[model samples]
Target: MTDHETNETAAEVKVDRQRPETPSYEEVLFYERKPAGFWVRFWAYLIDLLVVTALTSILVKPVFALVGLETSGVPWYAPYAILSALIFYGYFVLMTKFFRQTVGKMIMGIRVVSLKTDDLSWMTLLFREWIGRFISVTIWPLYWIVGFTPLKQGVHDYIADTTVVHEESFRKNKLLQKKTPDGSGLHETSAF
Candidate 1:
């Protein structure tokens, strides 16, 4: 080999293109596969609609009249759309940020969680709330599709990379666990 070629080979760095030994990307998907039942999710969504409607009625609905904003007052929309968007966006921000539960999800014992990580962030919640409305509202079939989606996601869930999972009942868990302080089998551990 030429001296220059030998020198070039010696200077070159050998690199192994291998990923780090950690969880796979799929394993870390936020939505997960724990699908919520149809009826369960449906009722929870209804609860959310009622709450949002009530809140929007109080806030956005009044704003139009107060500001003397009318359907003909503007060029584009009937003003109701603006009100709807205000309620839609505002309701989501409040529910996910403050309570971490919309009325429907709370009642049904299901929750929205981030798809990328275990923690639920405001951004994820916002995406889910806004996008979810599109799928959750349109019709029953669409809503069912979300529940049946492989990842347990509705439209918003898919868009936001989020998931809805059933919350384990605390009361049931407490009842089932009659344990000892040292962590032994139930029979020996049962103080109750």
Candidate 2:
């Protein structure tokens, strides 16, 4: 082959390699990813609160005791309270950042996903877990908005452009089938 021909063939092959395989009409399926409801999320958050309380009692209480710090009757801005707040925010931030779910969320079979990006970023985590959570915690009723929203998103979710969804809810089932030339069934599957 001529050099020009060979280069053209190589370019064609590269373009083909970059192109995605388009599924035929027979392979198309419709399925919706169910957003976590308020009750489930409430339970998950309750579990996380229990975990945070336990962690604070086990980890923070000891340090305060050892340092002769009085935790009782102290103001909210006290050193112990500040450390506890740090732990609270840190737990949510780190867990969501690393696993996309906290221990409670894992138990509840729910996970946080970003609507805007494929992967969660630090800024997203900070906004969702820290600042957003602080607001939710303060207002308390803002968490209830999850149930009312079309996508079942909480205030924090709205702020960070994230949503909680049931884990691995998508499954390949025979939602629709087509007959092949040999009378075999062609199954349709759902995609996330």
Candidate 3:
């Protein structure tokens, strides 16, 4: 080919190889739903504990009184203690399983969401509320881990792959625009 013809061919190739124009920065407005923090969760737990105590008092105390059974000075292995423990664990397990939140959580406007599955399962409830809660209750300090974790996950939350989130609440999140693979335009994905 002649030099002039070769130059024209090179120009055509350069034009063909030109990438599409894309914006460098794009401001995206979105809502990011944050998890329930430590204080809120603490208040909810306190409320639940009060409810459990009230239930135990109203339900078990009267029954023990009727039967003339001693309510005080009972060991952890005592029948009253066993029944109370059952009520405590059962309250959490059944409430979480059916409502996805306990009464306290409902009052606090928070709910548990399963991360590993679309819906909460029986096994998840058992693991989170019964076994995992048992550990948290025993250690107590493990509950504070929520304050430090990125997702505000506690021991039970980590074990169950669940997170507590505010119902019907969100914070505005601004994300920088990311370039598309073909450099066609800016792209943004929802934080959810």
What Cα-based lDDT does every candidate model obtain? 0.64, 0.88, 0.89
Model 3 lDDT per residue over 1-192, tens place: 899999999999898789665546666888756799999999999999999999999999999999999989999999999999999999999998889999999999999998878799998889899889999999989988999998899999999999999998887778777667767886765342
Ranking by TM-score: 3, 2, 1
What's the CA error at residue 186 for candidate 1, in Å? 30
* Candidate scoring better on lDDT of 1 and 3: 3
**Model 2 has how many clashing residue pairs?**
0
Residue 131 displacement in candidate 2 (angstroms): 1.2
Q: Tens digit of lDDT per residue, candidate 1, span 85-192? A: 677778766776676667788777777667689777777776676666656666646666764666557777777787677776321211223344444544322211
Q: Write down the worst ten-residue block by lDDT for model 3.
A: 183-192
Q: Where's the lowest-lDDT run of ten residues in candidate 2? A: 171-180
Which segments of candidate 2 are over 4 A away from where they belong?
A: 1-29, 170-192
Among all windows of 10 consecutive residues in model 1, the one with the lowest summed lDDT is 23-32
Off by over 4 Å in 3: 1-30, 173-192
Alpha-carbon TM-score of each model against the true structure = 0.57, 0.73, 0.77
Query: lDDT score, residue 167, model 2?
Result: 90
Residue 174, candidate 3: how far off, in angstroms? 5.9
Q: Write the per-residue lDDT of candidate 2 for residues 1-192, one digit (tens) a residue.
A: 999999999999999999986544354556656789999999999999999999999999999999999978889999999989999999999999999999999999999999989899999999999888999999989988999997789889999999999996853433434444454666554333
